[model samples]
Target: MARMCAERVIELDYSCNGARIRLVRESGQDDARHREAVPAVAAPVVVQDRPPADDDAGAQSLPQIIEITAQMAGQFYITPAPGEPPFVTAGDEVAEGAPLYIMEVMKMLNRMEAEFACRIIAVLCENGAGVEIGTPLFRVERTDHA
Candidate 1:
């Protein structure tokens, strides 16, 4: 789906499982020049592997880790604002629908939230740094009830 503004366009795309979604906005172009153009949304892709059973490694399945990624290309902010505590940190327990951070695109602050509860294992991006669409922001292990 897409929506067009005066000089920008916003689009949303999702997968069958809905575990991955992408939101992207493009601006700075003349609306008249790209009125008919449709922005593309890229969904997160995952590939899994299984080790041979004869290997010494345990037979347990690999933990399902979800990588929280940036939906748009922009600057990422860990804190709500300067001088404020971060919305979340490594080892933090994130609740579903809770704001995880912010992404600034085209001078607009877009709150990026979690779709499911999870425990943060690592933060992949630095605060106030530029991030591209689908860039991994956090590595998290999904909660049992997620």
Candidate 2:
């Protein structure tokens, strides 16, 4: 008996700063063909102006908010399993290496952990929502920074 092979196709489209980008991939395609389909361009570097330092007695320091993005496109989950409480919620302080969320890709669950201690300011994505690569999942303030 002989077995037959099936081809797979995947497409992703998104917009950034009014520029729309699209990606399409089909199984069994050569590297040259894939490269021709998508051209690479250098990303722009943004420089932000820093606030002037106050020499006076009443200087206010603001907490720096950081946005955590998805490393890969997948289904985002807050809990490890169905009916379970989330690993972390807004206003929760998470230590370094603590599990923050999970991404389900190709039937495999990938646990996302914090690289540094942080306070969860907000959960940006809904549980069980499909997210693309570079999608913002959470907004957190670094607690380890002084």
Candidate 3:
């Protein structure tokens, strides 16, 4: 049994006697039963680096866009209450620690905040939508970058 200390999930790959096997296990799961098996000949691994930019001059001047993703799986909410206005909208400037949105997990509400001052470029998730961990919630451009 493999122990997952800090990670929430773990994936492992094994090759034995020309057979390829993939094992996916979540934290706290003790079972290691083989899940997916594929012929070694049918599986190929490919790794590639980013291609060079076409126009270096323009690329260098472009503003950096940052994506904000959910830290946990939950139901996403735009406003604190049903009749209240949303915490933010596209083009809104937000300060560090400002509330961005709310996430409801297991009937508990968690307020999400901005880590740095930024301008909201877009709201990626729909209101009242179910979201998984690492789901993109917003796109923003940092305003405090020096």
Candidate 4:
């Protein structure tokens, strides 16, 4: 087997027969100490020498829909407690500092929030669903409701 190693999470991307795959292999313990991968525009980007599309609706939409991902690995939760109301649901207006939801990773509760004022367009994950580092939990549409 061909070995591909990196200090941190190594993202290997490729396309096969119209199927696209992005393999995100978690780094070793030592690797996490030196380099840290902070979630900042983690969306896939096709970098080309030429300038991007001028009227790029696709490009614009990429940044608008925020991705609440797992920092480590664990089940995702929408409510603070079981049988409790969810923080936000689809079509709900969310503020910048409002709590979007929680991602329980590594036995830790990671509370995710809206980067900016946005409305929850889609809830990609079901309640109590398992998630990895790059897994998308929710997709929010940036709205002017802050």
Candidate 5:
């Protein structure tokens, strides 16, 4: 995994077979005391194979997890401003079109919204940290809509 840490955002990137997977975390402060950034480098990966009989069961048992990716690369924010509560957190229920996070690109703050009703399972990026195109900001489980 390649970790990119900045004063504004935290990014975790993993690559396998030429495919890049990114995880983002929002930071609360610009200070380094917030969290240590992981260096961006190609990390060793291990692959495991499951027996044929387990394949079907595994596929069925796994819950569907949806990734919310960044539309453009820039800084990711969890709040509208400094010292404010984050827009969303893990386990928060969100409706379609709800504002989830914001990306600051070229001095513009672009709001990112949810595409469908879901519950946030995890937040991948840190606030004020830089991210790349298609970097995942959140992992959510789709919820049934009325």
Candidate 6:
């Protein structure tokens, strides 16, 4: 008797701002468990003198940019626990109440659930990375039904 093996090659490109990739080998899994962590980079703050006192009609409302922002500062996690499969991935249609991500703060895991059905448009955060408050973690499209 002889054993047959499969050949595979996986490439991870971490060519984004504040991102790191981690790969895991698993048995019977076609793709590797790819984990990523990204942190919010602080932007340089610029203060400007109050707009000419007579040239303002108050701040105008602009179209809003919807994004899933982190509530607190902590590391982001895709799976419920280490070595477990992720809750969702890009292009995965998730229904309301679906577990989307986890936030680990002070060693405590907080599960983040979806509010509405949507398709994962992009994963904005990296696994095992620190995210500041109000950082976009995921970008999803709100679908009629998922």
Model 3: lowest-lDDT 10 consecutive positions: 40-49
lDDT of 6: 0.63
TM-score of each: 0.61, 0.61, 0.59, 0.54, 0.56, 0.53
Q: Between prediction 3 and prediction 6, which has the larger lDDT?
A: 3
Better of 2 and 4 by TM-score: 2
Quote the lDDT for 7 in model 3.
Answer: 44
TM-score of model 3 vs. true structure? 0.59
Q: Compared with the true structure, what per-residue lDDT tens digits does model 6 show for residues 86-144?
A: 89988898887788888876677777787767677778777777987777877776664
lDDT (0 to 1) per candidate: 0.71, 0.72, 0.73, 0.65, 0.70, 0.63
lDDT tens readout by residue for model 3, 8-115: 347778899979988675745444463433222211111112343478776456665777877777789999999899999999999988888988876878777777
RMSD of each: 13.8, 10.8, 14.1, 12.6, 17.1, 16.7
The worst-scoring run of ten residues by lDDT in candidate 6 lies at 41-50
Clashing pairs in 2: none
lDDT: which candidate is best? Answer: 3
Whole-model alpha-carbon lDDT for candidate 2: 0.72
In candidate 2, where is summed lDDT lowest over 10 consecutive residues? 39-48
Candidate 5 TM-score versus the reference: 0.56
Off by over 4 Å in 5: 1-62
**Candidate 5 Cα RMSD (Å):** 17.1
**Model 1 off-target regions past 4 Å?**
1-30, 34-62, 144-146
